[model samples]
Every structure is written in C-alpha cells, then in structure tokens.
Target: MSILLILALVVAMGAVLYALVRGVIAMANGKDVSGEVQQGYMQKRVLYQGIAIVIVVLLLVVAKSNGS
Candidate 1:
C-alpha cells in the first residue's frame, strides 16, 4: 500500500512538472494573448500539486499506523 502511494505521489509530481513546463512554454510563445490558456495550465499544476500533497499525507499516516 505504501509503495502504491509512493508511486502515485511520483506520478502526481510529474504531472505538476509537466503542467509547469507547458505553461512556461505557452507564456514564452505569447500565442495566447488573452492568457486564458496559460491560466488553465496553471490550474492543472495547482491541482496536481494538491494531489501530491494529499498522497504524501496519506503515506505518512500509513507509515505511522504501521509503526514504521
């Protein structure tokens, strides 16, 4: 269970990274002058970060319960 949580945490973190990179690229390209598209990527990054944080909390709880 801990391993699964860890794997999920990694995937979530990767998604955050991906979103951040895409957002940066979009901003650099200046293709979306209205900034709506960039905002969407930012939102995704935030969501993924939240998921990663939640997974970390769950992992900690599991570890504590297991007396690790």
Candidate 2:
C-alpha cells in the first residue's frame, strides 16, 4: 500500500514536470495559437502538483502513525 502511494506520487510529479516542459515550449513558440494550449498545460501542472502534495501528506501521516 505504501509502495502504491509512492508510485502514485512519482507519477503525479512526472505529470507536473511534463506539463511544465510543454507549457514552456508553447510559450517559447510565441504564437497566439499556443496560448490556449499553454494555459491548459499550466492548469494541468497545478492539478498534478496538488495531487503530489496530497500524496506526500498522506505518506507522512501514514508513516508517523505506523511508527508510533
């Protein structure tokens, strides 16, 4: 179960990284057409970061509880 949560956290982190890179690329292109795509990637990046944070908190809580 802990391993599963760790895997999910990693996936979430990867998603955030992917979105960040894509958004940067879109911005670098400097085209109006890519604006919407960049926005979408930014939103996804935020969502994935949130997921990662939650996972980290859950892992901490679980570890703490188990340790006691």
Best by lDDT: 1
User: How far in Å is the alpha carbon of 2 misplaced in model 2?
Assistant: 1.1
Candidate 2 residue pairs in backbone clash: none
Clashes within 3 Å, all models in order? 0, 0
Tell me the tens digit of each residue's lDDT in model 2 across 6-57: 9999999999999999999998888856489899989999999999999999
- Output the lDDT of residue 66, model 1: 100
Per-residue lDDT tens digits for candidate 1, residues 1-68, read 99999999999999999999999999999989999989999999999999999999999999999995
**Which window of 10 residues has the lowest lDDT sum in candidate 1?**
23-32
Which TM-score value belongs to model 1? 0.97
Candidate 2 C-alpha error for residue 30, in Å: 1.7
Tell me each candidate's TM-score: 0.97, 0.91
Q: Where does candidate 2 stray beyond 4 Å?
A: none
